[model samples]
Target chain A: MHDTTDQHLFERVLQDNDQLADENRHHFDDMGAYVVNFMSAPGAGKTTLILELAKRLKDKLSVSVIEGDMVGDLDAERLRTAGVSAFQISTGRSCHLDAAMIARLLHATPHPEGQMIIIENVGNLVCPAEFPLGEHLRIVLLSVTEGDDKPIKYPVIFHNCDAVVLTKTDLIDHVDFNFETVEKTVKALNPKVELFKVSTKNGDGLDEFLAWLEARHSITLTASAV
Target chain B: MHEAAVALAILKRAVAAAEASAQKEEKAYAETAENTAPIFDVVKIVVQVGEFRNIDAESLEFTFSALRKEFPRTQNTELELINIKAIALCSLQNHQFHPEPANYFSCTICGGGIQNLISGKELDIVNIEIEQCLTETAA
Candidate 1:
């Protein structure tokens, strides 16, 4: 018997996942769909926000959703009931939705007729940040009821996301949440992260959020056309 | 837990690497000696886990230990995890500081935001130690 310690270096353990995500990006580009991966803690109102956005964008552009949950099709059922096209992926034991899951869904349903495809990732801050599902943009929801220190607590998710939607703003007055703290911490983690104060119930900042999404979707459409 | 998934990936990579090294050694030995069976045993796998990754070392180790018994090559393998500290560069003061656990957004000195993270957030399989055994097979 001979013992040998081979000097090998694999830079990232998630290299295979990243490669699959890149392939998914190419696929999304071919379909001319602007993909957004939504991540947040549980009960962050991801479904409600998507439904609101879909209702507003229905006349202008088509919107589709891919809902991911640990077990059940509850969110997908809600979206479908609201007259939006939604697909459900039950992850079973997985905390986060990996690129392979998305690839499998896409393979089964080759094309979705939405100019925008929003993937509502399994609700978790830490694990979801580690996996990228070929998304052109990543949005994280932080409700006012969840405390302002969440950005500090889960810095990676906030740092990696393209936008931070401060949800449940209508209840901001009732809660002890401080907006400035979240803004400062989120900016500290991500300098260029777009911050939005949104309340799906009151529709306070929904237009601004919709505008931002539409602008990005238009850019994706233009880029795909070229 | 996500650590379970990560542990599985680590084990798969380690076993694959051990088998690859064994195959190469077997090919080289076949030229010199015929009718010999080569067995590869994974001894140790070194993984680097960054502080920012939110991975629990004990959980990862436990999951890896539980799963390694499934693979004969890795049945007796030892998993070594090296923790890498997170260091971020403050944009305002240009200073580097260890971003405390769960408070990685702000700088320690200036309390300003970080321009970019200098280190941490690393998850990699650095190296593996393999033991190769050769025994003559009955022809």
Candidate 2:
């Protein structure tokens, strides 16, 4: 006999990934670490900003980094040379770091020492936005050299992130970047998001950003304790 | 491409769904000694892809076609993807309008910012169809 049956799933494809992410959250909570997931286009100054942030946070709090890259560990190497705790995950073909990748690393190795953990996701504006890495905060960096219209052109990334950092302010004069447009557009997309303008070359605006991070870190730690 | 990964995910889920149905059919037809175990064949799969997901249909289909061969259950399956439009509700006037991909921050009707997204961030499997066949041997 020939018979057909139709089943309705109506299931979200990312549900598995999201469940894994929640498990990662439990691991982070047990370790009492505040996690941050950073995303940006390639060469958007993510490495430089992370390097500087790690250096500053190291003095008062223990900080470690998990860098995700498609190739070499150049960025992770730089962080280690500066005496920061860093581990690298090389994603051979994947453009984004899913929660499963983090689970593999966290389970295989001992917890990296730190009250704060930073995950520098593989550089891509589109795909990275789809994956969540169990971070307390999500930041998307946009360099002035990449133009101010990026917030509007890639609205989904800006909309989903917790914050947006305007990087490479030192090169703003050389490029045709508009700060007002970027701020306005990002605000329209995510009104509650924190905005920061930073220049790793000059160390400008790093203090304010760091202060905000510290405050959030303390709040996260306090919340986890109870 | 990320589409390749997505295609694999879709195929994996579809295969599992078919296997589940086949198990039930096998149990129900067990009473007939002459009836052979049921064979399950996936016929069609419907997926809804949101505009915000930024997935290219051509690339997804190409990868799915190549991967379906690897899964015996889905070798005969056909994939149908429906594009979900990007929609936003205006904060000021409560108007709902389809926003352009480049400029989704603002509502076209009221010229006000979006309050919240009403729809279009969905990457979901709507349904799947399977054909089950039973062979009766001579008593």
Scored by lDDT, the top model is 1
Interface RMSD of 2: 2.1
| i-RMSD values for every candidate model | 2.1, 2.1
Separate clash counts for every candidate: 0, 0
lDDT of 1 by residue, B63-117 (tens): 9999999998999899999999888888789889876634546787888776777
- Which portions of model 2 show Cα errors greater than 4 Å? B101-104, B133-139
Interface RMSD of 1: 2.1
Span of ten consecutive residues with least summed lDDT in model 1 chain A: A106-115
- The CA lDDT at A144 in model 2 is 95
Chain A TM-scores, per candidate, are 0.97, 0.97
- Model 2 lDDT tens row, A1-226: 6798898879887778889999999999888788999999999999889999988887798898999999989998998998888999999999989999998988875646578899999999988888888888999999999998898778889988888999999998899998988887887677678999999999999999999989988888877778
Clashing residue pairs found in predicted model 1? none
Name model 1 segments beyond 4 Å from true. Answer: A223-226, B32-34, B101-104, B134-139
Model 2, residue A132: what's the lDDT? Answer: 88
> If you superpose only chain B onto the true chain B, what TM-score does each candidate give?
0.89, 0.87
* RMSD, every candidate, angstroms: 2.0, 2.3
